[model samples]
Target: MSTLALGVIGNCTIAALIDPAAALVWGCFPRLDGDAVFPALLDGGGADAPAQADGRFALTLIDQSQSEQSYLPNTAILRTVLRDSHGGAVEITDFCPRFALFERIYRPPTIVRRVRPLAGRPRLRIQLRPRFDQGRLAPEITRGSNHIRYVGPAQTLRLTTNAPISYVLEERPFLLDRPVDLLLGDDESLEAGIELTARDLFERTHDHWRNWVRSLSIPFEWQEAVIRAAITLKLCQFEETGAIVAALTTSIPEAPDTERTWDYRFCWLRDAYFVIHALNRLGGTRMMEDYLRFIGDVVEDAADGSLRPVYGITREAALDESVVPHLAGYRGMGPVRIGNQAHLQIQNDVYGAVVLASTHAFFDRRMTRPGDGALFEQLERLGARAVALFDQPDAGPWELRGSAAVHTFPAVMCWAACDRLAKIARRLGRDDRAAHWRGAADRLHGIIRERAWNPEIGSFVSTFDGSEMDATLLLLHEVDFLAADDPRFAATVEAVAKTLRNGDFLFRYVAADDFGRPRTAFVICVFWYIDALAALGRRQEARDLFETVLAHRTPLGLLSEDIDPRSGELWGNFPQTYSMVGLINCAMRLSHPWEEAF
Candidate 1:
């Protein structure tokens, strides 16, 4: 059966998910949101093998008995070792070439595979099958001297290989006496010898990743875990547009047999803010700088200063939801969605998200271009909208479809918008504007404190005057809505921990929603809870829970959106950016300071 244990390899431009057996199961071509040229991940769930589907690239070892997979240290390069029963083995190295070329970052939508025979005469069969339009269109295959082109309606892909094209085209098993290099990318011709080009790219790409990882200010403790999460989060960014996707592949159910799937290939302002904030903590300012460009475009495009919850990778505002019937969902879950309707919803939190993310650029002297008065004035427009709708709720951060409430989280986020504007104004020496925003922030703060608190429950509820707790309530301290030492804030934290704790995990909420109630734990909630615990001076408890959460990661040290509390199985989208952001945040908070450790 297919699982989220798959490994991901990509440049910022594109990524592919490879299963334990070294099969290319899921990938989008040209760009991250383009057609799924390799869609075996969503073809059928619980199948004996992905071979039952057609959209995959497999390097199958005859009489294969054991396999092992791992990332080349501190890099996105994936290494898989497969061994047959008769001591025959082959090593497969996979990566999308990303490095410096021609005085610029060179990241193409190409996947490079280098296979080397490691043991006694290994026999291998190479199958490269790519589909288009969600598996509804089969491309016209044409063979050249050394390359095969798969021509589709919108785009064409070329597979250039040093191996015999006849063997690859015929799917014939052949002896792997030497290393084989295959490059699947654009329809362009190779510039140099196949071996020389592949070798140069491999060396440069490896050096690029190592240099990039060396630049990160990762925590000393759990270095491996942090690096992996950081790399995965970086992979989720669409470099061309500077938009960070919520995940790679979508429509993976949050739990079994639930139609709770939603497309996450687009950018959610809320998720993007958290992603940038986490990366900033690691000294990854380049990502933040790139994302600011995307956010600036989003702000400029919002004529009314009202932002949507999500947008397309290329800044397309209209993300109409539609189902793809041609493809089965993750685990055979049906109704694979193409776009997100959340783009059309009124998500008030987005106002604050934009300001919070932009705030970093204004104060950091390290920024190449700091936020100036014009940007502050532009953000004030969003602040106006935040003030107008802070309490009048639409879909909250959870993006509930059937219900809209005066959710406390969005209300607090709106408060943050006003609060940040005040700080930014002070930084710009605009005393009058600062005073005005500070007053507005104070008024909203008073209102939230009075209305969001359920005195009987001793907690700030999910909604105003509602007696329910959700995991987001734990963010009161993290968001600076309340002080950690405040008795009310501590009480709210305890209330949420008591109300939402499942077996070893924390549920987002237990209340019934549009899809009955969520059965599994939202993975990021556990990290939020850990951060809250640490802020409350329960460091030991926080560290223990942080370790527990780390243990639940897939073998590749990756996480999905949700997890079964009872079984610890991952669910939802692959390589969820929210989950990775949480892991990075919690590791930074819980790790012992280097000065103390040494």
Candidate 2:
């Protein structure tokens, strides 16, 4: 299209429409760890190398008269309609290759793009830009009459056209462009003038997406929204490793004009349970089983059973956060960051997430019967560590900037670990260990009630000795640590709403008490509020807030980590999985009220 519209349908795939022209991709790789062939996203339409180091390309779509776009039912495939001033129209479809297993695993993914003249005769222009190795390494381009190959150290990008389009290579920005004919007549004669056809690839990719979608078992009334979210979650998954990343892009700010920007390209164990829960609820368990296997392998690889909060999609743990000074951040939020420093921090809550996810897999009706002794030992080890560190100060769930404390949320999760372990032990006939787990759980519950609770404020504080209320504690009710009818639980929810709710949304915590500049509302916290509202029997209010949160989604139904209420713009990383998890969980809770057993 003449105008460029960039948005995401799934958390993993990014699609753009250039009106009356061609569509371009933003940030997506064959695998989670693969390089970005389209580095122009960070450079702002400038020349950059392909995700591999060998080839480089940039794109410019011009001479567009008018255009429109839409998705294909519940699938991620995108269709664009273009119109020229001279009464001509063309249709184009764009998607990444996802058909065969071998193709899915291979590097340098193929972009299966197809174009057809729908109404009248409209001339089309084609441009190909491939930058390798984040646009830093140059590739050797081998050009033939109709085929082109950009070879890098580890991968090769091949482009072939059936149309007679002249191709030339430019050095300064590293781009290629050519004009092609779009002939339209009777259906029989139209094929004679067409330059190139990718109908085979298009059919294969469409069938692939359709078949995968058919496997989903979504019974909710909001089936379209649920399917969109489910597809996004699947796209965010690294197919080879079964690890799902938090988001697609990096350096999108959480707050304007602050150093809060961080990369969300890696996997977080904290999301493991939520991811599995979402998939299990939606009637898809294959991906969950693969993810659990990945988790088991990670546990076995670790010298100790203890795990890091985050890691690469491939299970690599060494992620060093650094700034790329050369490129300006999104909307000039300076110092684009790659990798995450939070990887090194010790977040004890992850242990609970892992235990809960594995246990869910074991108990879920769809999953294969799990090994009792192995899972029990894993839980016992994590429980033992929690008991030993119950009183220690460590980074809280938010990964705060200062020293750690006995964070209320982690303490409650520690209680969950002990509690779930006891249940599992009893089920497996480990009476001795079950007794020990129950005793430890009782002690942890007492600690949470005595140290974390603040009767003076009538709610639990953020930390053991602090007076500030945390929105994270609202999760205590969802986790079953406190019943919704408990007066103390209701008081804590009220305190959090009074303190953290900004308009209809909620902040992770009170910003005025923190060091960073005040930011927009966290999307996940708002969903938490929805869950709290439903649990409290405020179903209508919960649905209203859920719809309001949905209104913040981008034009293509993608969500970021945060939303700027004042500007109505998406902030933080795009297509955040945690945000989607929050959405799907709230939707499920609203649909099936009795599923809140946690």
Best by TM-score: 1
TM-score of each: 0.99, 0.87
lDDT of 1 by residue, 1-598 (tens): 6788999999989999998988998999889988988887887752245443588999889899999999999999999999999999999999999999999899999999999999998999999989988778888999999999999999999999999999998889999999999999999999999999999999999999999999999998999999999999999999888899999987888998899988999999987568778988999988888988899889989878988899999999899989988887777887788899998898888998999999998988889989999999899999999999999969888999998999999999999999999999999999999999999999999999999999888889999989988999999888789999999888988898898999779999999999998899999999999999999999999999899889999989999999999999999998999999999999998899999997
Best by lDDT: 1
TM-score of the candidate numbered 2? 0.87
Give all candidates' CA lDDT scores.
0.91, 0.67
Candidate 1 clash pair list: 45-331
| Model 2, runs deviating above 4 Å | 1-5, 9-25, 28-30, 45-61, 100-108, 168-197, 512-515, 592-598
* Model 1 misplaced stretches (Cα beyond 4 Å): 45-47, 50-52
Question: Lowest-scoring 10 consecutive residues by lDDT in candidate 1?
Answer: 44-53
The sequence of per-residue lDDT tens digits that candidate 2 reaches over residues 1-598 is 1111254423233322222234354444445545665545555332232322222221222234787776676666767777767676666665554565554532124454556666655655455565666555566777655556667666666666555434324322211123333211111222222343345445566777788789987645566677778877777777666778888767767876777788888888888877887887777777888788777767667646677889888888899887877556555555677788888887878777777777775567676757468767866778777777666777888887566677888788778888888888888888998898899999999988999888789888888977887678778777788889988887888899999888878888764534554578888888888898888888998988888888777655667788776666667776789888888888877764334434
